[model samples]
Target: MADPTRAARPPGPARSALHRLRGVARRATDHPRVAALTCRLAPRSVRTRTTLAACASVAVVLLVASAAVVLLVRANLERSAEADAREQAEVVARLATEGRLNALLPLDHGTDFVQVVDAGGRVVAASQNLAGRPAPTRDGDSAHDLLRGGDHQSVTTITAATPTGPVTVHVGASMRTADAAEDVTTAALAVLGGVLVPTVGALTWRATGRALRPVEAIRAEVAAIGDRDLHRRVPDPRSDDEIARLAGTMNAMLARLEAAGTRQRRFIADASHELRSPLAVLRTQLEVALAHPDPRVRSDLVAGALEDTERLQALAADLLLLARLDSAGRTRPQEPVDLAELVRHTATARGVQPHPVTVHAPAAATVAGNPLWLGRLLTNLLDNAQRHARTAVTVRLDTEPASGAAVLEVTNDGVPIEPDDREKIFERFARLDDARSRDDGGAGLGLPIARDIATLHGGTLTVVDTPGATTFRLRLPATPTPPAGG
Candidate 1:
């Protein structure tokens, strides 16, 4: 049974109101503006980076705006005060001209007060709020004297004239008042900022994080998969963006991994199954040899069984060597070696058991190779030649400067091999369907192994048919000989 809380509640304004508020909150947190801001900020950019940027902008704006507001306020207030003083002086000028100076210089004028002085540096007439002292002036010069002296008073100054022997008037406005007003304005701004800055910053940070929640979720999900679950995928962000690109790349990598894993598993299974027969045969043959009684039969069986075992061993060795050569092909360098000397040594080694084989190689005939691998390559080729030929095999090495390469060829007579089968003959485990092939008792890995080694060394191994002869050619990069020991 459903829990009472889990049970569906009948629709009403109370529940509907809460649901609507939650939906609105979710929309606000994941707003498009927040998402756009998060996207404009790089993925590599962290929360600290965004916060620092916002704070820096706020600092610069506050500093610049506060400076401008202070400057403007100070200028306007000072101008207005100077204009009032100038008008008062003008009134004094009018009154003194008509002989009524006491009327404008009213003692009841509390703020816009005025003062008048004579050329003798004394305040002969003054208004309220400035009656006891003379008007302030530059040191060592009387304010009245300066007022009478100059028409234009500089830097926080104003002047006017009267009729009685040029009555000089000096005027001033309070700078302290201007500064105090500026301080008040800045303080108000700071107070407003104290509340608003944190609110905006917190809202921005939370909204940005909420909008990028999908990306965060994807990162956590991808991290969890590791190597064990390529099948698992990150939920695609519905928007077409960098996250989509990331998902695409991941999916492509997963496909490649899945294919490679499938191939690896199949390869292992095939290798195990293929190797079993030879291993079982060798084990059973040995066991039977140990169980035999008569000397003659035992000797013959042992020799035949030994040959099979050697063949099996040879096959395994060739398989491993071929695999190594194949793997090394991707990374090995093709350096030059003396092809003439290499082939001659290889043929001599193969001919040690007295098969009718002759080798001829010109002195400068060279090949690009690892000498060890080149030796093995020629050895495999000579082994094949020895197995197939009626009696005589002739090995030849020649260099062609025109082609910029050295060529080595092994020719065998008395076997009319078809041209079409040349390519097929190089494949692993491919054998001619004949008693001659059976006589050699090879697992058919030689020619393919030779081709692999040759290819690894930056050369080609191919058969060239000439009527009744089959010549296997190995063409390689020409070896340069430095002057004898120089």
Candidate 2:
């Protein structure tokens, strides 16, 4: 006996077949030669793929429609044949019932044969085609039956009660004409399909190529562009479609790339110029000190060299910090820092200066950021203020009541900056003749670095117009303050 569990399980012949087909496909794909051949034959261009897809879809629709038309024609012909047979049979039965049946029954145009039989199933009258043959046996109880012999026939039978006894009539219609018509229709459709499918494919291929012409042009143009030619843009087709949008986006990307490339080149040139100046100074001081014999002069020269070295170190640190900030994927540690406290501490850390620095904090202002970077930003602002201030520098921290943002302002009593120079001053290595001098500007990276740090913390740093003093304002998104005594 078979296992009960196995017998109880549902048959999965279809599922098994599907699994086998998948396995074969996987093996074929894994074979190196098969893979290479597939890749070689596959449509690589979008135009070619679109053409193939359109052709396949049209072909499938035509095939299904053709089949439906052929089937409908065949069915209608069969129905017509059956109706003719039934009518002929009814007429013959009426004649036999009236006892006026002739020795030979007349055949209609569509009817192939007509026969009349008595109650004992004896052929009483017949058409010329069946003069002596016995009546054919009924295949089924249906009024219409298909009889197979030298030719296929649709036969219909009817019985009538006569004066003598019950009489039966049989009539058959030949299917030869209907079958011939069906065959002709099939041939016609096959020929039409042969002509139409290729026409569709050709039209699709041509239309697809035309539609993708602009894309091909764009690709060629982009391919020919070199890194130095990032400013060059692909031609726009000017139509408001996906292809047009694609061209517009590509132009935008090119614009951004050109700007970035310009910035990179400027940064390199400026950094080289800045380093050359200090390096020349250091080399000259070292050389002079090595040549001099007086101890005091040598010591002073060494000290100047040391100062240059320290400046170089600071410049290197600033460059590295800028590099890190420029990286798009860099992550930094963040914690909540009180802006008010940071301002006071940074101001106090500056020690004594020619221009006294004072801090005012009315309330605690908290923000989330890297404390080290924030401190550097504050220090840079204070240094800039002290260098340009005539008498006093002021640092004030407050929170915007309407926007809930932490606002820090560093003000100096100095000559007001020109409106045109305010935005330009934040650029790397930029200096103003009135506001910045080689003797005190200190390389011009401080403000830029400070602005970058502010941006990194999701804030803005700008020079706001203050009546008699130059004010640099920093704004950062504020965090919620803690409860008083929690």
Candidate 3:
């Protein structure tokens, strides 16, 4: 005996991806809660997926911050250099006025050098370290403009009457002060890049993850969820942001998926159970006939085998079609469909009485689709109506020519099904009778198959139930009629 519990249950789809950065190298300085959160989130999506988005956002901020630091340091250095240069120029001006510009010649300090020149654009004095005669100059006559800013390159000179006609006095300092200022700037930049980058980087990552802590908690809780606990949902922190909306949408989707999964699993189990009995009966009949020596018994057993084989075949086909329909979603196609004539022909072929089958179709209600799939879809609907229909099986195809969508509806009067069960009747192998009897012939895949075909044609197959009557409505988008000559 097959274990009843071994029957297959419809499994749920996989979860969304959200875990990449967390799985990377971690810090010991992290908080316990953050560690727990990381562990929860780490095993999810592959690394660097969400990391690039986060890194890109942080990179903009870090680049700006580091640039600001560099700018501030450089600005300070420029200000100090400007003040020093102004002070040095003032000292040299005072010496020239005192007539000591020629006396203080070739002066030098350990790392500093000075040069002074007369007013006549000639090197009057130079730093001791700056060897021999006048310091080299590309333009000796450009003294007027060069003196105002005390040029650092060649010896700086200004014209002044030095008791010996108009002469040029020049003075310069080796780039000690400017170099010191640059050294300070370089040191600051080094610290910012070396120290601040790592520190700020870690903090940025932690802060980002902290801001998204609720999501981490929700993910952990969601991952741990099983069928028994589907009703559990992540509560909304409700600051009205994308994160909150994500939590809300996830909760809603979970509810829908849970309900659908429960229904589907039950349906599959019921189908398996239903299939087992005929198989058992057929096997027993065959065994008994083979054991005995009666031609009649053998013939009867052979007939039983044939009938069971037919049922099995129908069962297998129904199961496969239902699986495809359920998995593909209701996003099928729309093509050339001639419902009025096709409806008449299918009814005639099925031998369903035309008197009961009312066709309210236009002369030609042509729509888009595979004709065979549509035929199968319609036949299933008609066949379904015939089973439980009492007085009539009314079929109608009402087309809205303007919008190019046609509505095909079949109404049946019979054992009044519950409002909810009317939709349930459309599920695979979903005959509600506990004691399997006359309803077993069709394999109960009609409504599901019809629904699939309707969906494939960009339509819906739904049940509108009233007392003693159930209507299966299939609304299919219409196909465009071919255009005439231009």
Candidate 4:
């Protein structure tokens, strides 16, 4: 059978309550308004935040450490007090056992209260501090030998089995002195904490500021750079760190932007000059026709004006196409185009020129691209070849077996381009000295536009060096055509 006392205790509450409370506290800290408020109150810089978080963490750790120290010191002091009281009580017990309780009267100190009591719970003798007082412990529960009253005093009792009966000796040590020492220690710790936290915070702030000085300097330098002066770069610390890497990356980006800006300025200047030439010719022809009334001169003036107008219109269209290509979005839909067929058609459509063109194309060389752009690319390549060729221009279209890429080559049997000038030929407004005249080169944007179109289709148009001929080669990703039945 179970004891009545054992059956009376209630079951404990579930342990998950503590976990739920912790979860709630975590969610509360994550609240948006609280986060916003914290951000507002704290410094915005990363250095400041890191420093403050470190200081706060240090302060918490210090506080916990000080509390632990205080607890340990208090525990030790209490143990020492109890030990002293126990020793005094043991001494008193010995004297009482020897029947020499009266001998302790002159040796007594006022701080420690000692008493000798009989089994009857009556005080037989007492020290100077407890003179005339009854026994502190009675029979039963209080008669048990123990230590108690540790706040202002520490009392210990020990029973001595004397010749007559059991005698209890009680000794109480004053806790006033130990408590005073604890107070002094606690006060000192509090002062140290107050001084240490602020000192650490200030030092952290200064150190962090010093570390971030280079970043601020870089920011100021970059900010001072205007659109016209993208050539300026941020100063690098040269250390292999995140900050140094950031500076390097920024300088690289600035370099690209400067190059692009220079290209844009040159493009605009070239376009303006090209436009002015045609407009001036058209205006001069119109003025000449008004001054002369002859039909032959009038007809000549009309033809000249028409030629200038056509050139102007072509230039405007090319500029518009370039602008559209430069935009971030694509307006044309991508589809599988027969590059071989496209090249053959563009070559056949062009009028008879100084050169005879020959087309060598496979039946089905397909590539993925906008059909219109691909046709324009072929047209530009053919036109360039036709103008430069002395007697013949050969157009070849086929798929490369290794890479499975569609290759289109326009080879002109003309004066070969210099090795050094091959890359420069694809730049907008780039013209060779021999073809600088308006009649020979049509605005010099055809090659650049063709290259841009090729790039849009994930392809490349490059001038390949030949033994005694000029060859413009185009490469596009090849796509397999579906079977007729499928």
Which number leads on TM-score?
Answer: 2
Each prediction's TM-score versus the true structure: 0.53, 0.84, 0.59, 0.73
Worst 10 residues of 1 by lDDT: 148-157
Instruction: Write the residue-wise lDDT of candidate 2 on 199-244 in tens digits.
Output: 9889988988877998999999999999989989999996999999
Write candidate 4's Cα lDDT for 1-486 as tens digits: 898975675444433776778898998899998899988997888887878887898799889988888888888887887888787777778877887778234323423677788888787877765567656544444522332333477677788987778987777777776788789888988899999888888888898887787799789989999998898999998688888988999899999999999999999999999999889989999999989989899999999899999999999999999998888255434588877788778878875676778999999887887899888888888889989988999998878888789888899999999989998989998998999988887789999999999888878889887989999999887765579999
Model 1 clash pairs are none
* Model 1: per-residue Cα lDDT over 179-218, one tens digit each: 6777898887787667666766777677668657777887
Residue 97: error of model 4 in Å? 11
Estimate every model's Cα lDDT from 0 to 1.
Answer: 0.69, 0.86, 0.67, 0.82
Candidate 4: which pairs clash?
none
Compute the lDDT of residue 453 as modeled in candidate 2.
88
* Model 1 regions lying over 4 Å from their true place: 1-111, 124-133, 136-155, 158-168, 174-196, 199-215, 226-230, 233-240, 255-260, 294-297, 315-369, 374-486
lDDT of 3 by residue, 235-322 (tens): 6766788888888898998899888888788877868876887789889888988897989989988898888878888778777777
Task: Tell me the lDDT of model 4 at 370.
Answer: 86
Worst 10 residues of 4 by lDDT: 142-151
Q: How accurate is candidate 4 locally (lDDT)?
A: 0.82
